[model samples]
Target: KEIMQWIDSENSKAKVQSSIHNFTDMCWKKCVTKDITSNMLDTTESNCMTNCLQRFLDTNINVVKLIQAAQK
Candidate 1:
């Protein structure tokens, strides 16, 4: 039982990491339109990525809440 719980915990961590990677890739492509000349992101690109990440998180939270409400 302990091993099963540990496996579940690891799987959850992996899923979260995968979600973060996917979100980063999607946001980067959507926000970064110009060529990558420098290591730092410009103001517009930075704001775009921030907004994109916020929107994704907000949407995810809302979905989870709705599912929880339905289950209850």
Candidate 2:
């Protein structure tokens, strides 16, 4: 039982970490428009990043609800 509990805990942590990294990558791609040479983000990039993050969170919440409903 103890070993099983440990495995479950690790699995949960890994899942959360994976989700965070995925969202970070998705948001970065959507928001960061400047080329490597520019080295600076303009107002547009900043706004895009913020909007991307918000939209990502909204999508996650909505999906979770849909999944829960389907389970029922």
Candidate 3:
């Protein structure tokens, strides 16, 4: 039982991590739509990437808070 619980916890953690990565990727593309290559090309892209991460994190926090409130 304990081992199963541990596995479930790890699974949840992995899912959350993947979700964050996906959100980051999506926002990066939106913020850097002009990139001609598979990689970020310049300081503008670098800045966009940073902004993408910030937006993802901020939005995730708000969504989580709403979920918690609804659960109450």
Which has the greatest TM-score? 1
Model 1, position 11, has a per-residue lDDT of 100
lDDT digits (tens) for residues 1-72 of candidate 2: 999999999999999999888877888887775575576667787788778878888998999999999999
Residues 1-72 of candidate 3 have per-residue lDDT tens digits of 999999999999999999888977786677767837765357877787778888778998999999999999
Error of 1 at 45 (Å): 1.4
Off by over 4 Å in 3: 35-40, 66-72
The local distance difference test score of each candidate is 0.96, 0.85, 0.83
Ranking by TM-score: 1, 2, 3
Instruction: Evaluate model 2: give its lDDT.
Output: 0.85
Pairs clashing within candidate 2: none
Tell me model 1's lDDT, rounded to 2 decimals.
Answer: 0.96
Which prediction has the highest lDDT against the true structure? 1
How would you order the candidates by lDDT, starting with the best? 1, 2, 3
Q: Write the per-residue lDDT of candidate 1 for residues 1-72, one digit (tens) a residue.
A: 999999999999999999889999999999998989999999999999999999999999999999999999
Regarding TM-score, does 2 or 3 come out ahead?
2
